[model samples]
Target: MEVELEIKGKKLVLQTGTLAKQTNGSVLVKYGDTYVLCTVVAEKIPKEGLDFVPLTIDYQEKAYSAGKIPGGFFKREGKPTDREILVSRLIDRPIRPLFPEGFNYETQGIASVLSYGDENIADILSIIGISAALTISDIPFNGPVGAVRVGRINEEFILNPDNEESEKSSLNLVVAGTEEAVTMVEGGAAECSEEILVEALKFAHTHIKGIIALQKKLGSIAGKPKREFKVEHGNLKDAIFNIISGKIENALFLQKKLERQQALEALFNECIQNLNTADKDISLEIANAFDKVVKKIMRETIIRKGVRVDGRKPDEIRPITCMIGILPRVHGSALFTRGETQALVATTLGTSEDEQKIDSLEGEIYKTFMLHYNFLPFSVGEVKPLRAPGRREIGHGYLAERALQFVIPSKDEFPYTIRVVSDILESNGSSSMATVCGASLSLMDAGVPIKAHVAGVAMGLIKEDDKVVILTDIIGMEDHYGDMDFKVAGTEKGITAFQMDVKIPGIDYEIFKKALDQARQARLFILKKMYETISQPKELSSYAPRIYKIQVKPEKIRDIIGIGGRVIKGIIEETGVKIDIEDKEGIVRIASSNEASALRAIEIIKGITQEVELGRIYMGKVSRIVDFGAFVEIMPGIEGLLHISQIADKRIQKVSEVLKVGDQIPVKVIEIDDLGRPRLSRKEALKEIEGKNISTK
Candidate 1:
């Protein structure tokens, strides 16, 4: 069966009942030439005593989808790329919240890009595909969510903009929502205003509603009956709550996080002892209900008391302190601390040769700026086996990179590869936002000439019974328990990047607008503090390599890189410097610790490619001696003919007596034949020396 809907003048086709029939639900969605097949499977038997939903969303991209072979030793896709992991998270966030509570039947959804059209984006299409599949599946998902990519071009919003349309856009926003509310949003912009962003969301939601209607119609035709499930607390909730009721208030409000956690744990343990049920099955039931009780205590405390666990108002941010140029040897470095979270950021500067080269479906790309984040166990007050960064770390680093990339100077303005590394020394909450603050300060300390100070803040929300509270700079507890974690980054003027996820069904546009408005205030406040630490980019460090850019003829690139790269290798070895030459427009970058070496390399390049002047004198080496004349290399590769008669003032019987291979001699450019070759003379050079001697007499 197939269902087609037209959204914003584009056709979205969803087809099923043709492939992967064994699964609960499978859908193949195509828009333009792009197609994605998403399948959902569920284990009917629920895992016992599981509180959190066991849902996994996987988004994978095959190279063959774009008519290319995979590039690896295994000739197959290995671990998921950063792009794939993020997409999986995008699909998981909206759908996970819609499942009925206690429905822990181990469901897995997989969305694979079968064919990628150049004009269509696969990420959002995959997001839409998973939603359609789950809606028609037997799983209890209250979703028929729709996703679209919005772009702002010439002050107008474009829905589901393709690659070409996005190129001219100032905003690249992706919004996912059902007809009732918006669930997920992630994208970047060039200092977009809050009003424009809010309008864009509304615009995207209107079109998304149509897509949702199509899914509902499709689900009614092919959807299976949802399995029945019931979880019994078994009088354990009453027993535990009765014992811990008196102590919940004091334990929830301890000013210190550790103290509060300890108190809550001790009280919960006492309640467990009061139950005194030795049956393993009964004990498991009590344990599960206790978690919900704890969440209820936290949420009710915020709602009734109008204050947080840390004795903060709803919109209060944590304490902050920042410093720049803390480390002497590093090109740039800063230490930023917000509340208990701390990030020590270091910036390194390098030559153009240090730029990272990446191969992707789009094309080959070179990145000049990169931000890497490292979250150590010590940062979180725990000890574990150390390894490479996980998906969370990569996602955080990419977020910070997107936020600050807009402020970085272009290659034409400041031509150097920039690397910023953030090491989380202490973490409590919103450490990724702390990274954004630290990276901005470090860039200024390195004299990177950033446009403005960039800072980020995360906001949290609690919604129950038509009441909502937006918390700014929330700690770890609130983030894990709250319904929303909305992070916005930007300068004081406007936003640069936006990322948000909700754990509830969805939040209406009113809540969305309030979050954006509150974040803008926090962003400006953070920026004010950031400027007091480091107002602007200082002078470039003296220890950094001085760079000079030069351009030669496009055809001369290969000549500069001689046969087998010998000529370029010799230059670096002889001068002890680094050089990068680009085939596009013949851009050459020479970087050296000292100015003398750099100047020497430039002069060497000029000697080979520069034209020889008729009257200028040059020191040349006699490369070969023939019967007619001797070939003296005036420069590296430019040779001139020095006849035997021109070898000496006196008639020489053989040129070998005066000149031999590897002999250094001064030669003058006397004339050039019509063939554009140089004719040189050693006799004329000697005559000038004799004339000077006679004139002194």
Candidate 2:
């Protein structure tokens, strides 16, 4: 089966029943020349003892899709790259909330790029294809989700902007939603106003509705009947709630995160012992019920009292503290703490050689600035084996990275590769936002010359029927029980980055606007705290390497680089510095730990590459004696001919009479020959020196 529609002056085609037919559902989506094939499979029987949905979504980009082979010794795809993982998370965030409650089937969705094009990104298409696949499958999903990429250039919003257009756009927002409401939002902007962001979301939703309708049309004809599965924990939940409702409420009102957590755990254990059920697994059911009851109480408390579990009002923010220069060795370091969350962020600066080389389907690209987030188990007071960063960590890191990217100076202005790492020392909620604050502080602390201090705040919403409460800076409990996890990051001017995910169907424009407004208020408060600690970038650390960037003639680049890079290598070894020279641009960046070494390296490079100019006087050394003229070494590796006639005011019997090898004399560049060699005059140089001496006298 096939269906087609028009979106934003482009054709969007969806086809199924022709590929991966054995899967429960499959759909192929094509937009521009990019094609994404999505397939979903679900086990008939639910995994035993599972309380949460085991839904996995993988979005992979095959090198072959872009007509390129794998770039490793194995010559095949290895593991999921960061881009693939981020895309998978993008698809999972919106789709996970759409699954029917208690539908715990072991489900998996795979979206692969079969064809890649520069005109359209495969990530958005993968999302649309997966939504269509789930809609047509037997999986218990309440989804016909729509996704679109919105870019704003010159105050005009462009739907599904291409790569070139995205470069010029100040806003790049990716929104996914159901027919009535938006489900997920992730994007970054150049400090755009809240109204502009709301307008963009409205613009995106208008097109999202059309795509959702198209998915519905495909489902009506080709979708399989949804399977019948129902899970009932209501009776157990009510029984547990009856037993522990009072205790849980009191425990929740405890202000401290750790104290409240311990109190609740003890209460749950007590309730379980009191019930004294025979079925060993009944404990798991009771535990699950206890959690739901807790969620219920928290939500009700917020909706009824308009205050969070921590006793703060819905619009109130947690106490924040910012400190910098805690670490002596690092280039920059800062510690930002809010409520129970803390991030120890550090910055490191390097030369162009430190830039990350990413070989994506589009081609090779270099990233000069990077931010990495690390969440150790100890941050949450858990004991687990250390492992590599998971999807959550990567997603958080990317969001924080984008938030700071707006204020980071361009490479031309500050020619150094920068890296910021945020380590979560303590976590309750909004560790990612803490990372944003710490990263900004550390960048400024490291003397990165950013435009402004950036801060982030996570807003939450609790909606029960008609009552709605917007939270400014939510804690862990509020986020888990709340309907929304909306994080906004930026400078005092406007928003730089934001991410939104809701447990409910979607949020309306009014709610989103209020959330943004509250987030902005919280962000400004945080930024004020940060500025009090460090308002502007400090002087570059003495330990940090100094990088000197210089431009040379394109033709002279080779001369400085010598054959086989021998000359550059010698300079690095002699001065203890790092050098990166761009072949096309003739740009040389020399980095050194010592200022003297950097200056010495620059002098050596200038001596080697600086061109000889006419009428310029230089202190030259006579290199050798020849019959017609004497070769004068004007610059390093550069010699000019000082004819015997120009060597002296009067003609001499022999060249040795006026000058000899190893003799230092003043010489003027009289002319440059056709071959690009300078003709030097010592007599005119002497006369000019004499005139200056007389004037001074």
Candidate 3:
């Protein structure tokens, strides 16, 4: 059946009786020509006490939708791209939080793009499709959430603008929410003012409400009855009340931040310890309940009371300290700490040969710059087995990488392979932002001429009733209690990257704008502090290698390469330096540990390829001596015969008497054959010497 519904600010048309009818809950949704098919399926049985829902959201794009083909060996769908993973996260973020706690259902949400006009964004459409599917599916969810993409162009806000319109827009913000409040936001912007960001958010919320309403209307027609599920509320509730009421007086009066945490930990541990002496099976249950209770109280306290556990104001940033060039051996290094979140970021500069090669759907490619983020368990006061980077690490690294990508100089401009490594020494919240700050400082310290300094900040929000407070430079606690975690990163002129994840169905435009505005203010402050330490790029370290670039004629590439690359290899071994030669257009780049090595290599290259100049004396070896002339070898493969008459001013004897094979001689070039062979004369060499002697006298 075809269903039509209108909610908040969007109109959704879902046709279930037609397309993708095989899936459990498949609906083709149209939001103007941009179409998406959302399919949902649930596992027959849930894992015991999984606690959280196993909800996987996958957003895949078909090449045919954009009139392109898969460009790889497989020629079909493979692993997800970074773009797909990001879009999947976008669809998953708002929906994940909307599912009720303790609902351990294994559900999957897949939004596939069958047709795209390149006008509407697939992300916003996917959000609508997911909501529509869940509203109609037998799955239980506290949802009907709506999402919208808001942009600011020419000082005016636009909703669901086409791809072309988004290019000119300053902000690319996605806001998703229920009727009451927004739960998620994600966006990037030009360095817009705080007021402008706020206004854009408000505009988005008003329109998104319409989308939410549409989902509810669609559910009314095709929705299934929600299944009955137990929300576990055991005797732990009474135990939690007793513990909090008993300790509320002391917990509320706790002054020092660490002491408060210690006291809370002691209280929770005491409850667990007591439960351990009780029944063993119920002990696990009691511990889980106690942890939940403490978390609930902690969240409630932040929302009901104006105070934070860390004792900082909502808009106050943690103490920041930045230092550069901490590691003497590295090309560049910086230690950036905001509150407790610390990142030791280092930058290494290398030649083109050291550039990273990646195999992707687009085939093998070389990247000039790379950023890696490492989050060790010890950074967050935990211990666990070490493993490779998980999805979170990849996502975080890409976020920071995108933030700094715009400022990095192109390979042709900088001619250096750049690698940035961020190690989290301590993490509270927004450690990724610390990566950005550290990366910028480290690049500057390495003498990388970035266009401008970049900085990042994570803002948070707390909403109760109609009142909302936006927090700047949030800590771990604020993030846990907060409804939104909006991270913005950019240079002083414009935003480079942004990500927003909310705990509610969605946030309003006003809240998002306020958080972004606050983030900008905090970002600027952090940048200023960084500038105080080092305002501009310094000279590269003396230990760093020196690089030289040389371009040769395309036809001469083979000559320089010689047979089987023997010539270039010989040059490297003789000079004791590294050389990279591109044979396509004959561009040779030489890198050496010191200037002398580089210069020596350059000289050797010039001697082999440069044309012989007239009057230039070259030390040559006599190859064969005949009566008529002595043939002398000048360059590697060039030989010239000097006539016996030109061997001396007054020669009356055989040439062998004066010059024999393997005799070293100094020769002067007097003429060249039509074939461009050097004609050497021993008489001319003697005359030149006599002229120099006369001049000296």
Candidate 4:
């Protein structure tokens, strides 16, 4: 059966009962020509000891969907790209919380793009597919959440703008929610105002109601009978909470993080010992209930008493420290430490060859500016194995990359490929935002001409019946227990990147706008401290290579690069420099450690391609001494014939008597034949040499 939903004057189609029937549930969602097949599967047996639900979301983009073959050696999709990982994250964030409490059954959801379209992005439709699949399956999902991409162009908001239209818009926001409240939000903006962002969310929710209604209609018929699973239920939760209520309040009152955690853990262990039970399951449930007691006390304290874990005001920012040019040998480096979160970001400048060549369904392209984020378990005071970046790392790195790309200079202005690697030495909360802040400082430290300095702040919300407290610069504990973790990053002027994940059913614009306003204040404060250290880009590191770019005639490119690259290779080998040439604009970029080598390479290129003047003189080489005349090389490859009379002032009977094949001598372009070859005269060169003839053999 197929259900149609009209949202913002656009038609969305959701169909089921046709594909992947073996799975718990499957649906094919189409918006215009774009469509995705989303399927969900739930394991029969529950996994053991999974503190959280074991759920995996995979998003794959097939090249054949767009009528193109994969470009790599495998000629097929092997791993998920950053975009795919991020979209998977986007779809997972909203629905993950809506599952039943303590539901730990293994579950997996996948969205496979089957048809590509030019008008819309596949990610938004993938969200719809996931909701539809889970809604009609036996899995207990509380909602059919609606996802939409909002755009801002000319002070107007657009819902689900096409590819071309989004490029021109200043805001690229993806919002997901049920009919009641928003659950997930992530996007980057062009310094858009906070009011504008709030309005976009409100606009998105109005249409989400229609999508939710359509899903419920399909779910009424296709939803399978709810599956039953057995897990021991415990009644000790209330008893454990009452016994630890007094100790937990004092523990949660401590100002220091580690200090508070120690206090709580000591009380929890003591309570377990007092129970003195041989049943391990009962003991574990009691321990979990003790932790819940802590969450409840902490949230209530902040809501009723207006006291935070750090004992700071809800809108207060943590102390900040910024330093740049810390590494003398690197291109650019900075250390940005805000409270406990620290990011040591290093910047590297490279040629165009360093750009990342991404092969995707759209086509192949290069990314000049890349931000790599690393978060080790030890950064949070834990020891773990080191491996490749996981999904969280990729997602955070992409967020920082999106924030900094806004202020980075264009390729036309700065041609070098820029890379910033942020290593989190310490983390408490909002380390990704810290990476964004540190990367901006590192770019300026490396003498990258950025438009403006950018800063990021993490905001938390504590909401009770009618009261709400918006916390600024939230710490890790607050983020883990708060209602919302709203991260907003941008310049002092406005927001650049925004991300939000909510724990509750939904958030209205009134509270959302208040959080943004609070974050704006925090952002300005952080930027002020950063400016005091280094306001703008300093002088580039002396050790860095000097880059020089120029354009020449398109026809002259062949002359510089001889047959089989013989001439350009010789220039690099002799001058000890690097050169890159482009065929489109005839652009040549030369990078060298010293100016002398760069100038020498330029002279070598000009020697071969320079237009020959009629009366010009050149120091020529005796390439071959023939009987008729010795062939002299006036340039690298342009040789002219020198007759016997041109050898010296005194007429020589034989050319070898005056010039040998390995000899160096002077020559003049006396005339040119009709075949576009130059004829040289040694006698005319001797007159220019003041009649002082020096013989060579």
Best by TM-score: 2
Task: Report the number of the highest-lDDT candidate.
Answer: 2
State the lDDT of candidate 2 residue by residue for 148-231, as single tens digits. 999998789999999999999999999999999999999999999999999999999999999999999999999999999978
> Judged by lDDT against the true structure, how good is candidate 1?
0.86
Q: Please provide, for model 3 over 537-605, each residue's C-alpha lDDT reduced to its tens digit, 9 standing for 90 to 100.
A: 999887778788887766666656679989878888888888877778677788987889899988877
Residue-by-residue lDDT tens digits, candidate 4, 337-361: 9988999999998878788998777
TM-score of 3: 0.78
Which RMSD values do the candidates have, in order?
3.2, 2.0, 5.8, 3.5
Rank by TM-score, highest first. 2, 1, 4, 3
- In candidate 3, how many Å is residue 464 off? 0.5
lDDT of 1 by residue, 273-339 (tens): 7775566435566668877787788898888877998889999998899999899999999999998
**How high is the CA lDDT of each candidate model?**
0.86, 0.91, 0.78, 0.86
Q: Which structure is stronger by lDDT: 2 or 3?
A: 2
Worst 10 residues of 4 by lDDT: 688-697
Q: Model 1: which ten-residue window has the lowest total lDDT? A: 688-697
Ordered list by lDDT, greatest first: 2, 1, 4, 3
- Model 3 CA deviation exceeding 4 Å by range: 1-23, 26-39, 44-52, 58-88, 110-136, 142-228, 232-239, 249-260, 270-305, 584-586, 611-697
